[model samples]
Target: MRPRHPRDVLVGYDGSDNARLALQEAIFIAQTSNARMTVVSVVPDVAATINAVWLAGGDPAQLSREMRIEVAATLEEAIEQIPEDVPVTKVLGQGHAGPVLVEQIDRIGCDLVVVGTRGRGAMRALLLGSVTEYLVRHSSVPVVVVPPPERLRDDLA
Candidate 1:
């Protein structure tokens, strides 16, 4: 039985092929549940670094501006992956990926958070940071992690 309330599905996209698959899954979930979907791309906060560098005689403002533009473009491309029939809101935020996603879930009252996994093996996942793993462990809301398509995996190898 699907919940009847207006579901808010939050998806994290970083312009990766895996992230694009997640967006497609999120759109399907939103369409089926009559939910509103949000596509979020996190831009890591560099203001403190910029400030420190500025105090130390370096200019970081241009770097920050370029980053913001890149993030915006990434978010826009992610949103374009969703079917036009699905309603979605695009958000560009500044922070580390995990915390930023959790915060946005709470801020938007999202019922579920969807993300993508690169399908790394357990050992590899442990050695390298995994955002999907972090969210699965820490998120208050349920999280759906989509694995990459078989063809995509084949292409990678």
Candidate 2:
């Protein structure tokens, strides 16, 4: 049985395979709990950097527009994967994935947040970074970290 307090399950989706697994898990949790599910995608703003580069060379506006379109398409594809019977909502926002996801959790008053972890170790996490780690450290709500699929493990092996 699902907890009563956590009537909402919020998930962060970025079109990654891991994120797709998280979405499936989130749907299961929401179904079992009879809770609402929300899928969120954060589109980082590249305007300033693009503009600066554009001033030097290339078309910033075109690039930015193309990026936005790509993001939207990705989100749409992710949404299509969600189960039709499950009650779900899609949220698209701007900013870094971690902060934006945390903010959305608070804004939506979600009791739990679900994310997929690519299993980055300490050194890699420190150098390359991890969004799951950021959310775990900063989120006000409970966060569930779903590991990559077994197929991924096989591939790695």
| C-alpha lDDT values of all predictions | 0.83, 0.80
lDDT of 2 by residue, 64-155 (tens): 77777788888888789777877777898887888888888889888898888674444454322278889889999888888777765443
lDDT of 1 at 78: 82
Over 4 Å off in model 2, which ranges? 1-5, 47-56, 120-129, 154-157
- TM for candidate 2 is 0.83
Per-model TM-score versus the true fold: 0.80, 0.83
Model 1 bad stretches (over 4 Å): 1-6, 47-58, 125-129, 151-157
Report the number of backbone clashes for model 2.
0
Write candidate 1's Cα lDDT for 20-134 as tens digits.
8888888888988888899899888897989998999877987788888999999999877777777788889888889888888888888898888774554564332367877
lDDT for 121 in candidate 2 is: 45
Q: What TM-score does prediction 1 earn? A: 0.80
